[model samples]
Target: MLQHLLRLSYPTPADHLDPEDHFSTALGTIFSDDLANQHGDRDALITYLPSTYPAYPAVELRLADPAGEDERRKFAHYLWNAGVLMAELWWLGREEEHKWRVKGHAVLELGAGVGLAGIMSVLAGAEEVVISDYPAPEILQNLRSNVERNVPSQLRPKVRVEGHTWGDVTSPFPAANAGKFSRILAADCLWMPHEHANLARSMRHFLSPDEDARVLVIAGFHTGRARMAAFFDVVGDEGLEVEEMFEMDAEGKRREWRSERDGGAEDHGERKKWLVLARLKRKTSINSGSA
Candidate 1:
């Protein structure tokens, strides 16, 4: 069954208008013990699922240093995203199912900004999880640090961090890893419309050939519906079929998000950002014949 997972709205810090700063301040307060007192740009610790997993323990994440005024990396310091959080919650909710899906399987995460989804996958019992992003030294280094700090020692061996750029199929690492992943995850990666084809090519190259192998994608609607639709179109051209798609509103309402059109009447207010989630699988000859 298709499920739309919604993120609960919380009050933002009024002092910081930047979403990243607001998130950092709010998270620091929530996970005070993990916050360091260093004054300069340093890592901040945030807790995930503090209430529910108190015994097993809330996951501690050491995020990358916040972007400075002249920071060249535009997307690295943005530690939090509604879609990624929603995807994490969805996986946590279906713990047993996810464990079954990932157990003894290879998993890969693209555009793993803070490594949350990939970290969660490792914790959920994936045989191996490769977390990847743009090949910026700072971004890659921070990603490695997060995986090292948060993931238990026993599971750390199963997680690896790599530097990957979209559309580089000829690269040695990607060429070697081609069709090797049973599961692929991408959260908030469709914001850039120009990168749609490149992202789709990467997905095609990495996605395993098995019928059950799948890719899970989640994105916020802030980038506009047209751009999101274009991404799906490119993915379709790359031979992936959307098995299920849905949207979740701030009120936790779940509704089907059809792939047929660009715009809808869905509210995009400050508190009403919609999350679009989809499960995709390779299109087989039989499925293509039917289409």
Candidate 2:
């Protein structure tokens, strides 16, 4: 029994196939010092290890998701292989305005698929971070466990995680979150056109109206420019102003591309635009008296 308890093991990269093979292969292609060569100083943006497995397999089943531990384990490997979470970590670590260095700012993260961006923000020094997504039982269960697993010992005590469903307008913000967040963040969340209205409304309801507040949206422009333009257009009419927008290339360098809404287009449409950072500002209340 003692020996069994002491046994430790983790699967190798070649051991499993993700549901999306291409994404998994692409992730394997980008490992290790490759990131340093790819992004230069920005290499510090993500933390990647040769093998995510423990040095020796020790029994720490507590880290496993009780509800869907198997499913969560598979998804974790897939996410690692595709470098999906790494992408968010890389983008959020930058010290620029779009980055998570907004310390002392209370933040809410929507559509926190796997909770990467929110966790990264806490690492990047926000005062408080809340990670939220739809309340589907399985997803929420895995989300809670993942947050518990990844919350750094140094930072765990500072971060919080909870369930939020964008589709439910009547569902109140978690009491701990009500009117408290000064910044809202979303990454790679606009790809689902079906969720656009709900995502936009959720943003409007929670984003702080204080002039100094900011809502940053970071997404990979894999779906083409037209759809991206339309999403922002719908949100614009609701008073979320796009303060600044910039495109980032595969290597994570800023590049020049005409925003479709701005009547601009990239001269060469070959390279993939891996990221877009949009800072959203809420409209000031005209109905309120000035200080």
Candidate 3:
């Protein structure tokens, strides 16, 4: 892990994907500017063990639908701050003001670490929700544990834990599932530039072809703003473009998305506090410069 002074108010989980030779059992504690915005939980101290994850979503916000995690031996490697933030977006928005809607929609969570956002979808009234990650027995097992523990028995039938490799065809998710999800959630999954093409392809594969179908994307700038930019470009190549996008600071202030930004790759302190969120849709003839 990157060695830095972790002056944590509350833990924001870190999305560490790279396999490491020497790994520590340290559960990263992060600042919760997001928690403060959604609820008054900024000062809550986080306590996480090797087996469990951090940032209790219930400490501050109340669920729209009361919903209700287990991995004992293995450390959760993919749970990150963006996943929590995504969950917050779905769960925290006031009923009258929520633009990020999941209720009564088919939802998919890509690279769903700990399946936080997907669980929130279940709680928020998604008609059906699929929480998927890389096809690993332990990871899928952990995801199942989280979903079963959180979602109510009545709502349990609405959620499915599936092991999925992105950009795959007709293996994990059946052919019937193509273009099935109206809302696809991707948080902190764009850290790898090399996988950008595959990620874009998968988004194109699963996203609904309808005008209302949308993909929700969020990623931290800790993985360089350039990588995030490259992801947009690749998605465009796959016929998906951002209908709306913006940069948000750790303080919850939002800004316009720009191609250029200072200190995104250099200034460590400022960049770590920055992330981008976007809504994507399939390109149409109207958006393809029909004149």
lDDT of each: 0.66, 0.52, 0.64
lDDT (10s digit) by residue, model 1, range 80-148: 454344335443346435522665779999988778778877877789999998877777888898788
Off by over 4 Å in 3: 1-76, 90-98, 172-174, 263-265, 286-291
| CA RMSD of each candidate after superposition | 7.4, 9.5, 9.6
- Best candidate, lDDT: 1
Per TM-score, what order, best first?
1, 3, 2
Residues 150-218 of candidate 3: C-alpha lDDT, one tens digit per residue: 777999999998877777756747465877888999988887787788787788788877668889998
Q: What is the lDDT of residue 81 in candidate 1?
A: 51
Question: Which residue pairs clash in candidate 2?
Answer: 8-57, 9-57
**The candidate that achieves the highest TM-score relative to the unseen native structure:** 1
Mark the 10 consecutive residues where model 1 has the least summed lDDT.
1-10
lDDT of 2 by residue, 115-210 (tens): 655665675677888877665565556556666666667877777667786745465554334446677887666756666777776776676656
* Candidate 2 TM-score, true structure as reference: 0.66
Model 1 steric clash pairs: none
Please give the range of 10 consecutive residues that has the lowest summed lDDT in model 3: 59-68
